[model samples]
Target: MKVIVGLGNPGRIFRTTRHNLGFRVIDKFRKRNGLPEFKSSKEFNSLLSRGSFNKEKIIALDPKNLIVIHDDLDLPLGKIRVSKAKGAAGHKGVQSIINKLGTKKFFRFRVGILPQQGKPQGVKKFVLKSFTRKEEKIIKRVVEETVEAVEFSLREGLERAMQDYNK
Candidate 1:
């Protein structure tokens, strides 16, 4: 079963921040695909939903079947990269997953959160701040594209999705 995980901190304050892009994408993907709403699971420390996608039963958390979607500060806004077996690149959320799973042999959909102008000073502060009105427009489009990419990856294959979407 394919297990898709979106990395983001939980809190109302972080709802619209750039760091919550993963959660945003996951919510959109879930709705678009007709998945049920996530329920909080204290045992796993996550909000989870169980459902099938493309006739495949979705369940469990195996490194081989895992796909993590998260924001990346390195790439320019509106860009996405589909990678596998890669390090977290200092993302605490991704690092935490890597630590728990004890392996990096999993797929990742890295959504760009960096602004077009340039990297801002104080990344911690910047990631927590809400996107500007202009930036929000771009983010909305990116989120839709990301959902499509996830669907494509499931329908086609991770390698094909990477070739087509990782531009």
Candidate 2:
């Protein structure tokens, strides 16, 4: 079973923000599959949906998968990286997940919000901010890819999905 988690805060204000892009993508993925409705699960701190993808048991899970997603200031904006990211890249959301899951070896479809630089002086504040119109266009594309990527990861194998998408 593969659990795909999208990282973001739990609030309406945080929605549509760059930080919540991960969650947004996941929601898109769930809706695209036309599976069951979401039920609030306190254990995971996010919505939950269970279904199959490409004949594999695909579980759309959030909150818990949050931990395994690393905090990397390395990835460029509009890029989504999937992998077994090592350690917490200084992200509280990922850190919280690590603390909850007690393991780092999990799958996370990382939605990049660009790296902190001179323009965005405060990383925390910037990440929570809304994305620009241009960025949104790219995010939409990436979100669609996220669904495909997760389904690919489940059916083909993580190695193949990683190789294909990481390109």
- Give the poorly placed runs of model 1, Cα more than 4 Å off: none
Candidate 2 local lDDT, 1-167, one digit each (tens): 55766677778998888778767877777788776777778877866778866765655444333312222345776676877746667778777777776877666677666743423678888877887888788778877877777767767877677799888
lDDT of 1 at 107: 94
- Per-candidate TM equals 0.95, 0.84
Top candidate (TM-score): 1
Error of 1 at 165 (Å): 1.1
lDDT of 1 by residue, 84-114 (tens): 9999997989998889989999999999988
Winning candidate number (lDDT):
1
Structural RMSD, model 1? 1.1
